[model samples]
Target: MGELVARSLIALLFVLNGAATARDPEPRRAKAAWFGNPPLLAVRANGAAMVVLGLLLVTGWQRTWVASGLGVLLVLTTIGGHAFWRAADRAERGRELTQLVKNTAVLGGLLLLAMP
Candidate 1:
């Protein structure tokens, strides 16, 4: 029951993320602001990797390794993109901080899913 709920939530998260990546223009701006405007190749690669990871999570394939990898990525992304930049305004900093916490929670969820 708990596992089912967790799996459902993770699936919903990934699906929503994929859909937003496909349809949202704001993400591009946010990515550029946070990630030093990485080259187009890098962006595409990240998106491709995200899609593959999302599929793995959704399908429950190699659950431990996939979730671990995703957790690591989320941590690294938060550190590299959000924590590294201390924004000038409280509002900006708060937004980034919230994202950091959110990513951490996602990491926790992935770790839980990886557990037996």
Candidate 2:
């Protein structure tokens, strides 16, 4: 049951964040302004994906595929949202770098979950 608990915890993380982002995407959109036009729409869509996919993962429905999709979303978010390379100062870079590392670890977990 450890695996189930772990999966639920991870999924919960995504679900809560996703719900918040879907409800208010302005901050994410602003952060990723350069990603595309209609940034708000994109942010909301990304958040919605996170919610749906995270639920699928928790429910063990197509676990591998759901995890893979979540991993992809995470990579996109890390690149656009964190972007440590674009930081203008030491403190900013450090903050972004921390986020990048945390996202990387989460992505690793997703990858393990994606394994058959």
Q: For model 2, what is the error of residue 72's alpha carbon versus the real structure, in angstroms, after optimal superposition? A: 0.5
Among all windows of ten consecutive residues in candidate 2, which has the lowest summed lDDT? 30-39
After superposition, candidate 1 runs with Cα above 4 Å error: 22-37
List the pairs of residues colliding in candidate 2: none
lDDT of 1: 0.67
* Residue range 1-116, candidate 2, lDDT tens digits: 87788789889979998999999999888777665534678899999999999999998889999999999999998888887888889999999999999989999989889999
> What is the number of residue pairs that collide in model 1?
0
Stretches off by above 4 angstroms in model 2 are none
Backbone clashes per model, in order? 0, 0
Displacement of residue 62 (Cα, Å) in model 1 is 0.6
Please give the CA lDDT of all the candidate structures: 0.67, 0.89
- Over 33-104, each residue of candidate 1 has an lDDT whose tens digit, in order, gives 555756555544555556677777767788888777667656655775676256778888888888878888
Q: How close is candidate 1 to the true structure, as a TM-score?
A: 0.74
